[model samples]
Target: MNQIDTGLVKRLIGEQFPEWAHLEVKPVKFSGHDNRTFHLGDKMSVRLPSDAAYAPQVEKENKWLPILSKELSLPISTPIAKGNPSEAYPWPWSINKWIEGETVTKQNVRDLSKFAAHLGSFLVELQSIDASKGPIAGAHNFYRGGLISVYDEEARDAIENNKDVFDETVLKHLWDLALQSTWRRKPVWIHGDVAPGNLLVKDGKLCAVIDFGILGVGDPACDAAMSWTFFDKSSRKIFKEVLQIDEETWNRARGWVLWKALITYDANKISNKIVAEESYRVIQVIVNDYGR
Candidate 1:
């Protein structure tokens, strides 16, 4: 994939949003995999999908962020302008109100349990919104917020191929438990990709949530994956208690975490040291939680 650099962004801005064309365009230090995000100015951001697969999110975020932002307590990325495709930029892009906060990380958070509660409260508020006309989980989101079974075969393949790297027996057991039952309740709104990068923190507290590209309505269990991905046992307990999640849903959440960690570990172990290490750490968290 060709990288979208600062030069191309300047051209696109100059061509379309000429009003803000004079503003300096700089690449954010930590951009995401799906999109190339740049600081449009001091107050807004310009996000362009890296490929065709991620292009659809421009419409999704632009159309739905306004509707979802009003009912929720936390601030989310609201689109200010939509950019059309041009010779310089092949796909649709967006100009969003730049959210102010640092990305959440273990070192930055002062209290894990308290932070978990804050996140839990946000999820509760988000889910309570009426999802009658919301989009159902599908390929649009890579099946996030949908059935965990969607990745069953791929997860098994990772396990089978990596028997020498990790504990295959325990991995199989966890996968089986995830497939034991499915979400039976009505679908609710989910952030889909609730990782540290998507969460914003200020003064050691969660302030805003971003990247609604995969936002959709579906089983809430997918959101719970953060328990294993980001939280410790103590904080996980606080999160689950605050959200009032049941045992079945909790188990499914573990499955969601396991599937992602397993695949991520397999894919990046040799190529990306940072991602591989993080994925391995999450895998350990899942195994430890399963044993407890």
Candidate 2:
């Protein structure tokens, strides 16, 4: 996909949403792989999916974020206007009420354990919402909230291919543990992607969560997977305790984290050095914790 620059964004907004076209369109500092986000003046954000695969999330977020926001304790991205495809931009896009906070990272947090508890509380509340009609786990969400076994073949392939970097025996053990349990309970709402980039911090506290592009209803274990990616041993303990996650769920969460890290590290090791390194670090965390 071609990079979405400020000029493209400005032209799209000017064509589709003439009212807001007059507002300054500046590129946001941290745009993710799935979408290009730009700040529209001081109050709104413009988000355009980088490709067709991610385009569907525009409608999904538009349709569900308002509903989810009402139920969630923390602030969420609220779509203000939906943009249609034009000559300049082909994919559907969204204008959201700009959230005022910095994306949370490990270094910026004042207290890891407390932050974990805050995040855990938010997830508990989100899961408690009525998700009877929410979207089910499937390809739309990259099979998140679905069975971890869905990625078993791919994970095994990654393990085998990366034998020089990982221990085949230990990776197999972790994979087996993840496959041993299924989500026996009723499905619940899961945030699908809960990495630090999706979390916002203000006043040294977790203030809001954004990017519900992968939101769905299914095994809550997917949300629990962030415990490994974002928290340390002490903070992870607090996170599990606050959420009251069971042993089976925690094991499955480890599987989810391992699967993502393994595939991500393998796929991007040479092409994208930064993500590869980060994914490698997460893999190490999972292995070290599992070993203990």
User: Across residues 235-264, which tens digit of lDDT does each residue of candidate 2 receive?
Assistant: 999999999999898888899999989999
Candidate 1, residue 270: Cα displacement in angstroms equals 2.6
- Candidate 2: lDDT over CA atoms? 0.90
| lDDT (Cα atoms) of all candidates against the true structure | 0.90, 0.90
In model 1, pairs of residues that clash are: none
RMSD of each: 1.3, 1.4
TM-score of candidate 2 to 2 decimals: 0.96
